[model samples]
Target: MKKQLHLLRQLVQQAVTHSDNTTSIVTDSFAVNQAGDLLMIKDVMIDYLQNLSFSKKPEVFIKRKILHTQRECITLLDMLPRTKMATPDQVALADQMRKCLDELLRHLHQHNCYFSCEVNAPYIEIQRITDKTFQKMTVMKAALKRKKIYSELLNIICAAFDRFHLSQQHTYQHLQYMSALQLSILKLCEKASDLDFDYQLIEHLTYWCFNECHFVDYCKSLIKKALKPHYGTKQCYEQLCHFEKRLTVQQEKANLRYSVQRNSVKYQLMVFVQAELECIEKKQQYHSGGKGVTLKHTAQIGSYRVQTSFSVAALAYFMKLLCESGIIQAEPRSQLLAFIAHHFQTPRIGEQELSASSLATKYKQVTPRTAHAMKAKLKELCQRIDDDFGSGD
Candidate 1:
């Protein structure tokens, strides 16, 4: 963890120096490169802190290290030269770095180590079940029929739901455990489906299940309700703050316990799922202008009329393919559909024009199997064209 932090510090130094060297008239590429550097540093620091929180070190030792690391990050950030005339992009980048540092400090100051032996016992038991279920998933992946695999996965998920219900205390650690189990179930589903399923879709479904079952939100509401009586009192404020600290500590301890089995398949699956989710979040932020950077959208071709006949489903599927392949980057599904509707003659049912909502619904319903088949067909066609045309050359 220290090594990772050291690497993060170096990245900060490099980024700061690069920004300091910027000319008065900054080129677009230079600004982008600088933003990328800061973003990389932020990601590295976050991963480092997560790893530290999950280490098997003593609580006192971990807390001390966190404080020190937080200070170091703040000091490095202070070195970033600030100017009154700084561009909005530069200001946004600096604000992002500062926000990351603030979160790190909050993690250090919060405490969450209030679990008694009786309370802790349930978590241990759940951990055991998680490990056992994960092992069963690994062993049965190749041998079990898809139906059996689905049954086993559903059983484990149901068991998690049951355990969550039986618990008297709805601590944050319990929610974390439930979340980890959900990710494991998603992995099992992906494996059973021979990786033909849309991971994002499965992730959305799993989270939706949690919401529909009222598991996560209920637990959070319970905690908040316990603190509700103290709303305006100073004593209440202090008590609530203390509780938050303890919650943070307890959550880290839970992470540490899970990290003991970090080499397990389930653990790797959790990591992969988290990384993919983060990637999706970053992409959304980039497209939505959350990074405080202004991007020019320029068209390479002049407007032209297009006469095409295709069902909404076909058009939606093609748009999805293009976005997933990086050929297009229209986000929010609606934006992409709107672009297509504007430029092409879209098919419509008798009275209604092709609606963005309808197209988005079809987009979600498009199966991965169909997408892959279409992609393969396109590749084969391209190969044939290349082969036939190469003879003339």
Candidate 2:
């Protein structure tokens, strides 16, 4: 037993050393590395410990050492890049770790030392124990399926989040645990179609997804604001500031950029629009007239731009020109025009509606051509809306 403990300690040291020497970036062929070798040694130890059939009392000191080594190995395994463990060797070792974790939990459970509600253990810690234990009891899985564990973990996580309010201390580790719990619950769902999940877990997950979806929608709207045709430096700067604040808030909770892949389009769009806005701001402060910049209508759009200024209408017109020039697609052009028209509650600029000239005077300067195109697009969109959802007079 002492010899085995020595081997385990040596393996852990080797694994930790190899990991420290390696770069943080995980590549595809990591399984062939020395890190993989050390991990496999730990895997062998797990198997050896699991196979130990004792008729007599297990040595208390030896058991303590084994548990300590198991913990270090678990931590090291977690620190290893999950996505880089694609190779068979690395993958096998990972599976072995999970198996070992389950065995350890089982051992503790049989000895009545594993389950304690007093500690208020973090969800990740409980998850590590419960997930493996459930996996081990595959035959009695349905009966062993514990809703209390799921509910308890959720309560712990929610309490932590509420207490700290997502500041630096409460974020990274909490998010890591939340993400792992989400993945584990999802996997459990996939395994048993009839398995009932706790309502708290469901509600929490739903809220999380809804929050991310709202952020994505908000980003889309912000990009539209930034790209509006007559938008000037000041407006652009203000919009950028608003978007940055929201991004900071989201990042403080979780890495939404990584978790919500569908919102990547919005992220890319925001980045592009922000860069353009910064350029516009610099140009406005340096080269352009302040607060009263004016430009003549370069083109006519059914009297939409009697006089042009930089504003949302003008911005839409600018995007129309990009569309005409094949710089942007027709679908996005239509969408932007529609968005502006809906928000401003006007389809075209006229004597009755707000004049483009007045808007330009108040806001920033916009090219006449862009304003004209924007109004034209808006008019077309209004007519289409009338065709689709017109009231019967």
lDDT of 1: 0.49
Model 2, 1-393: lDDT tens digits are 345445544433444444455543333354345344545554565565554433243667445554554455445434433323434654554454444444543443354332322223333354544454335334333322443334343444344333333332222233444445445455654553231234323333433442344334443554564446535545556555655554444322243322333544334445655676566666665676554332222234323433334355455456445666788654323233433443342334433444433433322345667666667867988889889999456
Worst 10 residues of 2 by lDDT: 114-123
**In model 1, where do residues sit more than 4 Å from their true spots?**
1-127, 139-176, 183-309, 313-344, 347-353, 356-393
Deviating ranges (above 4 Å) for candidate 2: 1-4, 7-68, 71-102, 105-238, 248-251, 254-278, 288-393
Q: How many clashes does each candidate structure show, in the order listed? A: 8, 11
Report lDDT per candidate.
0.49, 0.44
lDDT tens per residue, model 1, 141-163: 43434534344334444555556
How big is the RMSD of model 1? 28.1
Lowest lDDT 10-mer window, candidate 1?
112-121
